[model samples]
Target: MPDAAPPPAATPLAPVPRLDAAALVAALRAHTGEEFELVGPLPGGQVGAALVRRPGRREEVLTHWGGASDATWARVARTGALLERARDAGIPAPRYALVARLPERIAVVQERLPGEPPTRVDLALVQEMVAIAGRGAGLLRERRDVPAAELHLLRSGPGFCLHESLAQYDERTRRLLDLVRRIGTGHASRMAGDDLVHLDFHPGNVLVDRTGTVTGVIDWDSVGRGDHRFALVTLRFDLAVPGTGAADRSARAAATRWLDNRIDDLFGASPDGAATLRAYWAHMGLRQVDWAIRHHGPDDVDRWLTVAAARLA
Candidate 1:
């Protein structure tokens, strides 16, 4: 008998559909039975948004949509509940008017707040924002009901860490990956925590008035239970991104310094503080690189990889 032929390799699944203005408006109308005029696209969202004028409402609201799994949807609902609790406790955050779960996407209609992100993040502004975040963290500290499994970081999909993805990259990235693995393994015990963490807390997600007052914090899609220090790690990385404008560059430098000082004040005296901080930084880099690989171009990948490499080095 002739030898049997080998099975062909499996084809990769197609990327999820990104909802644009038209699609978002349609989804909102279908799910909520409310018509909204498309204002325009909101800037700086990793997941896209459509600013829509709601009928009979004086102020405009935002409809945000992104590719999401069932688990993601569950987490979003949990986050919305957490936000409501935070609001009750005097924490400033967006109120979710509606959360529509479509076939492969989830859309959230939230109250658009009055302020915009600060044009320049000076030290004073950073201090104010940190205080605001601290208040929210206080509310989160009261919650002990979320499951440990759900608290674990989900890196966009099933895979949690970056080791597998880094294997596909060059030697430089792999070296970074090795360091990430070492740090993560050393600090694995500290990964689980009961505090509510806004995994993507950063300047872009922060809304501030003209006077640098934090009016509202948006984008609760990545909220979960973890060390609050992890959130600060994310903020530091966000501030360190290379910027095009002089103000942006200065703000980044200042914000980075402010966050370092704050972290030092909070944890510098602990025996394991430095190691724990390094571990969180490594995790942030891995998370950014993995997400960029899937959603962005090579240059984006290289940029985040470089950031991670520098920290790990």
Candidate 2:
């Protein structure tokens, strides 16, 4: 058995696909003439992945995805090439060893990059993460092939960034949903510009070494082109989450505020900055809240509501 990838790029995720290591192993063998064995479950991704080893040589990360349209998967297949550009700009991303597109799913085998998931989140970590986000600014400005990142506030996205959860939660959430919907409809349906948007940019998706330097940014399943500042907003919401790290609640709040201040420092001079921030903020709010409502219990949802209230209220 193996873990699945992120859900589709269209409609609701009903009967989704799963990852089969044997099928991928077969696919890789057929495509690249490689022999690999499933190692273990790789932790710390919204979509699950597994470690696959090429004995006596090196290891690779294996991911299997489905439900996205062929066009979407085609765009996804191009991400590995996009990584080359990211690497050129000094960003640490992995290279795809192979891509096996089967009738039911897409299997990807990529060269494994270094570092383990960061065990804790601190101010230094925050700064480094924000720096990582900054490194991606305008990286894709010239690449017209990549699609714009959808805000997903006005409606549900493929399988994540849902909007209906907030609408059903309660009066408070419904009001917040209204704000998010207003922003979603008022702003462009998709994010503008050509920056490299790690649609799920957060500490969890980042891998780091012992000294706390980020070695690689993993999980580009939903990667797209958009304003890099949107990533900071996503990071902001993640920091505001209860156990994302930094010792305690107050410290997490401080780290989030510090990040916001950094955004202000960079964007306070630009007229569109606040507006851009708010739109992204509302989108992330809907994403987190919707996921919490559907997956976690009431308290978890409540915590996210507090986070949303900071900006949406």
Candidate 1 lands at a TM-score of: 0.81
Name the lDDT of candidate 1. Answer: 0.67
For model 2, the local distance difference test gives 0.75
- What lDDT tens digits, residue by residue, belong to model 1 across residues 197-217? 677788788888888888887
Give per-model TM-scores: 0.81, 0.86
Candidate 2 lDDT over 67-181, as tens digits, reads 4468757776778878888888877888898777766667787888899988777777889888877778888878898889888877888766666556555666667788888
Per-candidate clashes, comma-separated: 0, 0
Q: Choose the strongest candidate by TM-score.
A: 2
Strongest candidate by lDDT: 2
Measured over all alpha carbons after superposition, the RMSD of each candidate to the real structure, in angstroms, is 7.1, 6.2
